[model samples]
Target: MRIVKVMSVVLCSLGIAFAAMAKDMNVGFVYVSPIGDAGYSFAHDKGRLAVEEMDGVKTAYVESVKEGPDSERVILNMARKGYDIIFATSFGYMDPMLKVAKQFPNTVFMHCSGFKKAENMSNYFGRMYQARYLSGMVAGAMTKSKILGYVAAFPIPEVIRGINAFTLGAQAVNPEVSVRVVWTKTWYDPATEKEAAKSLLDAGADVIAQHQDSPGPQEAAQEKGVYSIGYNSDMSTFAPKSHLTAPVWNWAPYYKQIVNQVKEGTWKAESAWPGMDAGIVKLAPFGPMVPQDVQDTVTAKQTEIASGAFKVFSGPVKDQQGAVKIADGTVANDETLLGMTWFVEGVVGTTE
Candidate 1:
């Protein structure tokens, strides 16, 4: 009888230890593209790596997830597997993530570059347009043709806003500068992006800027001996000769903060759109070809932006039709920026 009681006590202790071990949080990540060495997915994967290093957290990720029903299946499977927090890191995953969040009320779903939200889901993105503006300053000063090319992924508001900000910044420096845009629709197609850049280069564009994930446009510029600005991450390594600065994302701090909030059971669904002031969006280092005066100008403007003394979308803004959009001395609010559907003056492309 005594031996049997001792065995029961040991078994109970083992069960308790197993329960404690299971308490570790399981975090899952869904990526829209392959996490290559650089670009949008790479930037977010860096954040995932950082969060995985924290104690008592186990991380899992599925890369190259399509943004449709396939993504919904993957997300649902992750939730079913007992993932505590899931991050769908793509704009197209918004609806799917929301649907999964509804079915799994206990799991937390965070969607990047999206607007929808549920009780267990939240949206987050940076004001990347601010950084795009800074990079445009470099493009405007370096371009001899006063004609810039933008290789874009989609015609969504995010891409539209970035293009507008880039045009505004270039015009701020060189009034005669005009921006030409080509939409590839796909976010991470290198061949298509390179072809689009070459087409722009053939059309007298001396400077190329891109919103696509790959360094294809930068590579094309280097081959043609032209300048280019990059997006998502620093792409100078891919085209050292023609590389200018890029708009970069720093998502590690935000990821760690969200993980901690979820761990503490204090996380709430909120729309987070942080910018330069929060270190969420920033400019990569300028290339050697950038003149000192231009660098100084961009730096001064960046400082003003960080201090909230300057607004990128401030008034006297106009559409392509020469009609005034925002009156003089006025500023566009978050609502106006989020719902942007028209091209600003100096843009040479259709938003359709």
Candidate 2:
């Protein structure tokens, strides 16, 4: 009787150990750009680091993966290697991830800044325009020329939406301010981005803003003795003289929640677009050059936004052609915001 009891206890212990081993997850990440000091991929990599801090999770990543066939191959390799979850952190990886997800249905896939999803795949992004608008206010208040230069990436809805929000925020504070955009057609080219910034500076823009991934624009502004706004992460470190503020991303919280869902077996394929209220998107600290009154005003507005008392895309908004796109008292819905293709009034650029 004693021997049988001991045997039973040993079997139970073994079962518990096996269950713990089964809970271990192998996660992977695919980055379109090098996880340099700062930028979009660097921000996502920070999220991956947060996930690693959790129990029973192992992480791996392949950075600077080109967004075409190379990304598909890399994703398929990770899925085959038994990665339980994979995050494709680029807009162009949407189709590649979708195709790989179909083949590896058991492995969950998450794509950032894209619209495609599958039974085992999901998409996630933040309403970064909220932060963009606030940064625009800073530019409008600081610019002597009233001409803000925006160095842009591709002319997708994401870029267009940000530019419009910045322009709208500037016009709200300084009615004479106008934004001029120059596209780089690349997300992470420092040389091209800097040249674009210089071109804008030469064209009478006293302030510079950007949607590109590098701090080249900020550096350019610093060299030219002008103020600049940054994106993806705080760029003040790169351009102390010119950095005003940035609309930064904090991806750690969202990553931790998603990993927990996967571990608890509650993971589902859905689209998530969180905003300031969720702490997914935020503004970097103001530069020393920003005035106290300007900081107070921005803080007041930021509080209103976080508490849901104000909406950035509320109506009475118009396009550059003087035609009202959103009538007064009527707010634009998520669908309209996501599919935005026109510039707001006071913006001088073509979507094409």
- Residue-level lDDT of model 1, residues 1-352, one tens digit each, is 9999777545543433343246998899999889993799999998999999999998999999999999999999999998888999989899989988888766778999999997678899999999999998889989999999999999999999999999999998999999999999999999999999999999999999999999999999999999999999999999999998999999888999988887765677899999999898999999999999999999999999999999999999999999999899999999899999899999999998
Evaluated against the true structure, the overall lDDT of model 1 is: 0.91
Candidate 1, position 129, lDDT: 96
In order, candidate lDDTs are 0.91, 0.90
Per-prediction TM-score to the true structure, in the order listed: 0.93, 0.93
Q: Which pairs of residues collide in model 2?
A: none
User: After best superposition, candidate 1 residue 251: deviation in angstroms?
Assistant: 0.6
Model 1 poorest 10 in a row by lDDT: 12-21
Per-residue lDDT for 1-352 in model 2, tens only?
A: 9999777545533433343358688889999888893888888898999999998899999998988899999999999998888999889999999999888757789999999897678999999999999999899999999999999999999999999999988987999999999999998999999999999999999999999888999999999999999999988899998999999999999988888777766677799999999999989999999999999999898888889898999999999999999999998998999899999999988998
| CA shift of 167, model 2, Å | 0.7
- Steric collisions counted per model: 0, 0
